[model samples]
Target: MKRSKPRLAVFKFASCDGCQLTLLDCEDELLAVAGQVDIAYFPEASRAMAPGPYDLALVEGSITTPHDAERILQVRRRARVLVTIGACATAGGIQALRNFADVAEYARAVYPRPEYLETLAWSTPVSSHVPVDLELRGCPIDKGQLLEVISAYLAGRRPNLRRTSVCTECKARGTTCLLVAGGVPCLGPVTQAGCGALCPSYDRGCYGCFGPAESPNPPALAGRLAELGRGPDEVERLFRTFNAWAEAFRGGGRPA
Candidate 1:
């Protein structure tokens, strides 16, 4: 008897759907991937949905509501391996900035009737609610790396992912450091690799879209920025980007 293909499911919660889109954006590779694994459920791609005991589940988004917190538990129950994709699933994303501010004030700022909206005071990563097998980080994850993750899971091997900084990629590409060349504030030294140093290659500073590296010395980088004439407010804003809630970037001095 032929062995059955592994069932795969893609889930969404409180995200912009950009990460899920990355999977679809794979184009040529996506067709080959579809042939390898059973696309059990992907509502973003099709209206059809399948029931689980799924072999793998790719979850994207933060737990921002009481209902979302409950739903993640159900997904965890059905999934053998749960992988969180994107900054929203891994570090709580930009929406987590609400954790530092008053949610009530934010609601009033956006909505005419704040009382009608039901949302948690803070947006939090998926790991806060359920055990995650892996985390793929980015504002929108890179499709090539995403394919490697899927391939590894299907082959029952550990995914070969790097925890290094984007600066490595910059050096490999022979791109001049923006900070050294033009004194631009860059998160390249501390932001995780994956974006292939795209921004810096085009002469722009990294905006921390891939989040903090495995063990970033953010304070040291902040001091360097200060030397470049950046002030306290700029330093704080630098840390408060895509992965603001990540521990490495958060003010308390721990890995994010």
Candidate 2:
């Protein structure tokens, strides 16, 4: 038997707390959403963690520790619907650069008491360890989109997230094509829409903060970047930024 208002929980593992902050930042909408559901276990907002068989779980962060790997399974069991929000939860985030290197060696170099640390070799997405119902991609995530997702949840419908590229967003905003006009080696063509085509509009290349667009052809974009005087190494570095461990971005902008 379900309650009149569904209970929602927010969980975190290895993250910068950006996405959760985005939820809190939805100031006005948060109040509205609060009326629709019970925010039962959001540690960032409240300390009271009601024992859950949560109706909806909004998870932020990657699984970077052994405990988190186990915890995600617990979360899955408790959550009827699990949505991974942000790059960390969906594509492993910026810290996933460690995936390409020796984590032990890096830990030893960075920490004076490296032996005290207990962590996984790779900072991995939540879905790698447990089944996820939906993914909201971003470093921090957009408040409007977050509200849309929550609204969809309350209404018992699929959240209509756009799968278009940042290039498409640029067109919608009437922002000039920096790739064509400024010859910038933008990742807009292959990157997912969101961030409002932020970087490109500000005279910088899109860094793919939202990861790959639907069926992204990264190699094709790499070729274009190469033509724009970017070397193979440079293009590889570009793909390794925010969503480094994402499957589409993992091959260093190779064909996905």
What is the alpha-carbon lDDT for the whole of candidate 1? 0.90
Candidate 2 residue 82 Cα shift, in angstroms, is: 0.1
- lDDT (Cα, 0-100) at 20 in candidate 1: 98
RMSD of 1: 1.6
| Alpha-carbon TM-score of each model against the true structure | 0.97, 0.97
List lDDT for all candidates, in order: 0.90, 0.91
Q: lDDT per residue, candidate 1, 1-256, as tens digits?
A: 9788899999998899999999999999988889888999999998779899999999999999999999999999999999999999998998989988999999999999999999999899999998999999999998988999999998899998888999999999999999889999999999999988999999999988898888789888888888889987888897887788887887722233
Model 1 regions more than 4 Å off: 252-256
Note the clash tally of each candidate: 2, 0
Candidate 1: count of backbone clashes, pairs at least 3 residues apart or interchain: 2
